[model samples]
Target: MERKQTAELTNLVMVYDDNGNVLVEEKVGSNYRGLIFPGGHVEPGEAFVDSAIREIQEETGLNIKNVKLCGVKNWVEFDGSRYIVFLYKTNKFSGELTSSDEGRVFWMPLEKLRKAENKLWHMDQMLELSCGNTYSELYFNRNDSAIKPILK
Candidate 1:
């Protein structure tokens, strides 16, 4: 018999600077690699926005404000576990970028992220969804490689 679907919460933040460059991290995790935004799991009982802020600070050493919930993404693992991600974007931040064992953080042009050499996961879709005006959600069936937008 198939196992029941279990839900898990996570977060992803797109930090942009005054120069229009977005902060990308080279992930050290085995499951994911290459250039990606700086974010991670929300701590237990923490407010979603607070979690975003905390993850941003921990991963990038930046205190960010104007934390906007721009989008959401759902990834259904092969084991029937669901990972829900809250996507945030912010231009208002302070402090120097610091390195973390999670990844090396740096600023890069949006176009550079789109280039062929970059190994970001779903870079085009992710960029579009995060920059979208309205809040959105996307579901990806990791087992089958199927994806579609979802309603809240």
Candidate 2:
């Protein structure tokens, strides 16, 4: 028997350095690495903006002053699971970043992130949008799924 399709929303965060570079992290409890962002699942009836702010603060220890929606990505796959992501960008934050459950955080050059191990798959697109100063909604069909946006 096949599983029924279910839709879910994930709040994704991309933290950048003062120079506007993406922060990458080492994988916790696994050898695999990928670009790390401070984000997680959105609770039911939970607003996206609130979720983004809460997730960021919880994961990164930073309180974002200005949060903006930059993208929304939707994915459907053979497994009967559908994933939707609400993307937000914030350039202003307070407090220093600390170690978290996700992993250690470090700033990586946006221009050459694709080659980085544990590199988030969509980084390139996110960096581009960051440059353009626009928020975007991206759609995907599951081949493999990841929401982190890293630069190429």
On lDDT, the candidate that comes out on top is 1
Highest TM-score against the true fold, candidate? 1
Give me the displacement of residue 107 in model 2, in angstroms. Answer: 2.9
Clashes of each: 0, 11
Error of 1 at 42 (Å): 0.8
Candidate lDDT scores, in order, read 0.83, 0.67
Candidate 1 Cα lDDT to native? 0.83
Which TM-score value belongs to model 1? 0.86
Q: For candidate 2, what is the lDDT?
A: 0.67
Model 1 ranges with Cα > 4 A deviation: 1-5, 133-135, 150-152
Which digits, one per residue and each the tens of the lDDT, describe model 1 over residues 1-152?
Answer: 96666788888899997776999888866666788898888778899999989998998899999999878888878887888888889999999899788899999987788774666666566777887653387778887787776544
lDDT string for model 2 (3-82, tens) is 66688888776666678476555556555556645587888999888888887777778888677776676777667687
Clashing pairs in 1: none
